[model samples]
Target: MRKTAHRMVWDIFLVNMIIITGMPGAGKDEFVKVAKSMGFLDVHMGNTVKKYAYENNIKIDDTNIGKFASDERKKYGMDIWAKRTSKYILDEDITIVDGLRNYEELEYFKNNYDDIIVIAIFANEEQRFERIIKRNREDDIKSYNEMKSRDDRELTWGIGKVISLADYMIVNNKSLEEYKSDVKSLLKTIIDSRPKIREKLGL
Candidate 1:
């Protein structure tokens, strides 16, 4: 049964997943926008968390959502979000997963899928805080103190370690145009190199 189940998973998953992770305001959403424009489908872990909160009659604010995600991790193990998110991805050639939070989730994908590339976006703390203030998303941090607190919580979950181990790194501190151009080039490179990646993976 275990062998059959593993075979089922192997048969269901075909192609590479680019898992994107970064600090709260590190422009991962912007990177996903660029990837989507280049015809990549996206699965946002943040959206998964938000959906769960909505279905459970929980408030969708940052604090509530943060607590909810943390509680679920505590209950189901550190990779709970990855397990939940993986069910939504089917046989897309290249899917991007945004908002990865920890090393456990990274490992879950690596162990199950085997054909995933991890990308980490980087921005300085001041720049990230500035962007967060400008975006004002429903669950975005409002102030530097709030951002710092959120950063602390995420780092505690091993996000920093995951970020350090990414297969690719993109810095997002420059102007929007420059950042978008860089992202576009990288996506094209990844798409073009798919055959080589597949060969390396023995796929």
Candidate 2:
């Protein structure tokens, strides 16, 4: 009976979801990390990129990869990577998606899931660039040219279009406390709506 109860709880966890989006270094990762600590299951699209890249023999940090992805979407249509990311949403109470880089991805999920919500995080370009340098991951970029190029790629690929269309926007220009405040406020609203949303959408 206990095991069956656990399975039932786990199944409920599987389907709740929200997509977190922002320009590079807008603190989407940090926000998602906090969300994970709370109750949301954070899913980074980069994981899908790296995994799919590995499976397909494509380079993970290849120059022009973002552009390539955009072009591929143009040729192949929406949700190539989205389909992979969606898999992780199963069994998680709340799935928080990070790094939404195109409008196509937004529409795909929005069309498929009636309860989908896009949360846009934003910071000044200079602040975001500085934060990106601080992360210093393998993907951490150095030159302004490199960062600019990637910025151009995402911008041209309609990343901003989705960001601008987001149902909620959090401007993360100050300390984490300020960001947390916005998140908490938005989360309360989302929490309150959960019953209605679940019933309306059959989640």
Candidate with top lDDT is: 1
- The candidate maximizing TM-score is 1
Q: Write the per-residue lDDT of candidate 1 for residues 81-140, one digit (tens) a residue.
A: 998987677553567899899989988888777478999999999999999899888988
| lDDT of every predicted structure (CA atoms) | 0.84, 0.71
Q: Model 1 reaches what TM-score against the true structure? A: 0.89
The sequence of per-residue lDDT tens digits that candidate 2 reaches over residues 14-82 is 245688888788888878866665566678887776676567666556363565566666767766777
- Alpha carbon deviation, residue 18, candidate 2 (Å): 0.9
Model 1, residue 173: C-alpha shift (Å): 1.3
